[model samples]
Target: MAVAAAAGAVGVPAAADTQTAGAGGSQQSDIVTLDLYNLTDIHGHIEPVFDKYTSEAGLSHMACYLGKARKANPDSQFTLLGDNIGASPFTSGTQNDNPTVEALNKMGVFASTIGNHEFDKGLDVLKARIDGSDPTHYAKINFPYLGANISGMGTYLKNYRMWQSPSGVKVAFIGAIEDDVATKLFPGTVDSLTFAKPVPVINDLARELKTVGGYVTGADGSTGTEKVKADVVIAMFDNDVERSYPQMGKYVDGLMGGDTHKPYYFTKVRGAEGNILSAVASGSFTDNLANLQLKYDRKAGKVVDSAAVRIPAAEVKKCGDDPQVKAVTDAAAAKSESIKNTVITSKAGKFYRASQEDANHVKGENRGAESTLGGLIGDVMKNSFRTLDNRPIDIGVVVAGDIRSDLATDSGKITVGDVFKVMPWSNEINYVTMTGAQFQKLLEQQWKELDAKSSRPMLKLNFSSNVKYTYDPARERGQRITSVLIDGKLIDPQAKYTVAGSSFLLSGGDSFTAFGDPEVKASKRTVPNRLDREWFGQYLEKNQNVQPRKAKSSVGVSVKEEPLKDGMVKAKVSLRGLSFSGVGEPRVEKVTVKFGANSVTASVNNTLYDPNAAQYSAIVTADGIGHTDTPADVSARVRCSGRAGQTVHIPLTVENEAGTELVGAVQGLGVDVTCPAADGSVAGGGAPGAGASVSADKTPVKVNRLVRTGAGVSAILILSAGLLGMGLSLRKRKIG
Candidate 1:
């Protein structure tokens, strides 16, 4: 269906990717060319933005490119890989993503796979948007949402829709979403849905199209009248890594992937039978479009060759935006500006979410660690829910994943738009009663099973200030949680406690299924759920000025030791989970370990290069007040940014006084003192450098230097004597 004449005449675009494959031959009447264009992870970016912090390419420019490309080749079909909506910006997000729908209608897309974010509200809300049944939204989407691996759509979804050329050369476009979408959504919203692995599903569909070549069937297996076999297959998945699914190239000529939001193209995936498949990834934020072309020979009934090129969104500048799409984007911007400017709170301190640092110390958002913002949100939710619902909730919980943005005022005032971006899902407060054992299970669930398709190996759930816990990641999964305390008291395993949070979390969102237990779900719901964003705004407005939590509510503490020795001892204590991301979270610089009243020198080797660097060693000695009969009290502490204390009392096992006694033998004014046991315990390899010890009753005094040898000591006395003699001569001359 793709015409060669409509293409090439437009000339090369600016900064177009140089990657291209399979040039065409001369005078080919039997050849059929199909042009396919795709975009992924738009996330409702509909308006052009050029700001100090960021600049978005927006839908108007994206639509301009699509219009020109499709017009140049009438044989083409505009399509999307995934992430057409949800997690949108203020312009579209404020209006329930209606502007995005309107913009997509102007682009004229044929079909799209479902990104995980599409399920943010639930399956029903997604359907309502797709069919334009909701009167509150904008326009009806002309594109069909396709997913071969997803069930519970009844008959609305399709697997592969064939596009036939004039001479009957058919190319089927197959769509399948990632398998783990269910885990990322609210439980009640998707209880009826089932998402399967897309790799096997795509393989099965390719095999059937190649061998069977029968009538197309609906999602429910209802066969349709149209019958055809694909001469070429282009598969779309909600993944960026082409290497992850090596077996995918069986019958596919090209692939488009999404959901890492990285801008990259030109990866070759090896197909079955040693055939190489061209893999192309467009960019997120509507920044680029992946263009793929295929040449099929009618005589051979197979695709002869294919090539791909990534078209950047900047190319639209040369051609300009489509007038109709630009109008919609501008309208959206105007509509949301008032709400965005409405101040929600006065000037406030910054609150930052968790982030991860790479080996080179480059940082980005990480949902695996706790942060000050998450803790504050948890407190806000708990207090607001208790007062509003008239319920006695023992604990409040909020996961790192739920917090999408931070609260930092650029204009010296917090706005509604800023708060909305932080809690965009508009989740409501829900209460569930869970026993202490189940709560422990939920805490243990932080270390989740690693997924090939997902990035989070561990997810952190931030609890209110009243809750404290310690975890050791080195331990087995279920046994990682060593202690859990609520309200300064050890949690009783049999006690029933009511916890409040988003309905998604209360129902075990993000795979924390302990909260989804039968007893927890069946608990009485005496009051109606309150929207979390409204409550949070009220909480902030009442306080006027907000500040981040100064210290971490929960900490990770563990100890590793060699055999115990009482005097002049050393030990390694693992101080981990201290390196949290963002300015608001405390940044631990060094750790200190104290034995009785004697504090020894310590050194820490914390680095992103090694996971074992969390283990810091400090020298502990029985030299001063540590010279006690009973075990000396050991305190492990940390010095972090903006604060100097996190005193964690840890137990130390010191060697008994029996072996440590210095055996003194006196004979004619010569005394022999034999030290205990040749320095073996916490000795040898990892001990810190020895330094002069401080007495138990006094502060440390810094000398110019330590005089190590006898020669150095004599040199100091000679200098002192010369100075004294010079002073006496000067005094005698003055008297004369």
Candidate 2:
């Protein structure tokens, strides 16, 4: 039963009035005010912690505010939108989010819709937690989880619930999640569940409640005996208000939205008939709670007025914590303290993750770009899953969003908690073999145009040490990737290579659909039971001391051509390079051209190559070029050189010395050289050919020779003598 509250207050409404007059004057206008409060996207933040503003944020403070509000308005009904748990800190995540559920139970959360994170551990685990079926670690949720659109195997959750106000006006609440849950959740989390469109389900349920009276369905498929006839219907969705309110407003009297964590209070959503519905959303991490007061007219069976009031976390004047919530949070924190404080290893220098400043400086924009932390994690993943099922992992991919925090800048002792903060998902590593073409497509997907009107248009990806690539944002979408190298070799589009990444990528999270292709997923292999956090911890422990490596330079080329007399062509090639370190100049060692079974090495035009600007421009003159009547293919290659040295110091395991410094290998970039055909005819868009292709020989060029010193010769002689003596002893024994 819904309890109504007194409407007269001194405060102004947050938005314009969303009320309609009764059709007839004879109908009695008995108005009752129902106070509804909502909280959303807490994400298991049980204890108070410093937010970006350096102020306290936690469930305890939220509970203090809730208690105060309920005391003032005793008829208030408290609800949650969803995303109460998952992707949480060590304190809550380690305990499987039981603390959050228990805290919510104590705080008297009436009902909630399922958020994407609720299925992070899969449907079975969610069911166990909700039903308290897991005797070992489980708590019974006092409120029901409502999902009207979800069906099939996990239909145990309620679709709707009915409550009647003290004034005898009934209100029905329906819950639903976004239709795209399958893509957002971890793979296999909701494989057996079917999510239908929210509109149809919400509308049908609303109609049933308004017309023939709806009944709540039990988890065990039992029918409820209580018939629910509501004068007002409210739909609670675990989706953003921008997406849900407009589409679902006509069917329900009010809406509770979640999943973006933005606060939107008392916005009126109008229907086709000019009927206005109220909607509200509370911000994430219990930062704010919304109080929506709906004035329902029993005679007209409609809401006469609606307004919302938001209570910010800072406004909670209470200094003490809720006793019950504190008890659960304290127990969880105590268990997490040991793990959080345990030292994983030590660091010699700062390992930086991508921050707003770093992203802006690196790419001149802020979507997400590569950083030192990304590089370190990529290296760790590559080394950990180098060989799986006898297949070598050629490249390791870690998306920019996965890196949560930077390593401690002080470079002192690194703790287990530090590593957990960086890679909190605990995602398992998986390997998939993809063709070179598919790999190129995978890289292309990283640069996304989120929407037509979005101002920010880039998403950067972190790659393993062995993988390097250059992209041109100025080029077309499929043509952006100018060059790619794997294992010091050019990526051959026709060749197949095994790549390693998290299950998130393999499950097609973040819209990297190239990895989630049905054929590629069929051949995916899990790297035993190793999780990303475990691998990173082990790597840190083994390395003992680590530091950020110097960034490498990515280079590309563009060519221009002019037709000359006597069947000749002049080609001007420009090589441009961008150093990720914001330093290190690029220099071209040599340039060569290949045309129609003929190869020519160009003369050294050292004057055009600029070390300061990191660009090289040269004009190559070719005689008797494009002389043939038939179209000929033309290609050019440039060998650019750079150096990388050891940036961190670590003790050697085999010998008593520091780790060896890395020697950066020479990289190459190529472009199709354009040439005019005989009689001044341009073939295939100014490039004289049907099969003109440019490629770089990624094989490292040996610049020096190895010399065996006296010690090395002596060791070989000693090994030879030992083998000879062993053979003689065996022969003597056989003769005897």
lDDT tens string, model 1, 120-172?
87777777877778757545666777889999987567787665433345567
TM of each candidate vs. truth: 0.68, 0.64
Residues 517-632, candidate 2: write the lDDT tens digits: 87788878888767888888888888877766554323333333322222222233333321222112122333333322333333322222111110111011000001111212
Q: How many backbone clashes does candidate 1 have?
A: 0
The predictions' CA RMSDs to the true structure, in order, are: 16.7, 17.4
Q: How well does model 2 score by local distance difference test?
A: 0.57
Find the candidate with the highest lDDT and give its number: 1
Q: Compute the lDDT of residue 231 as modeled in candidate 1.
A: 68
Error of 1 at 188 (Å): 4.4
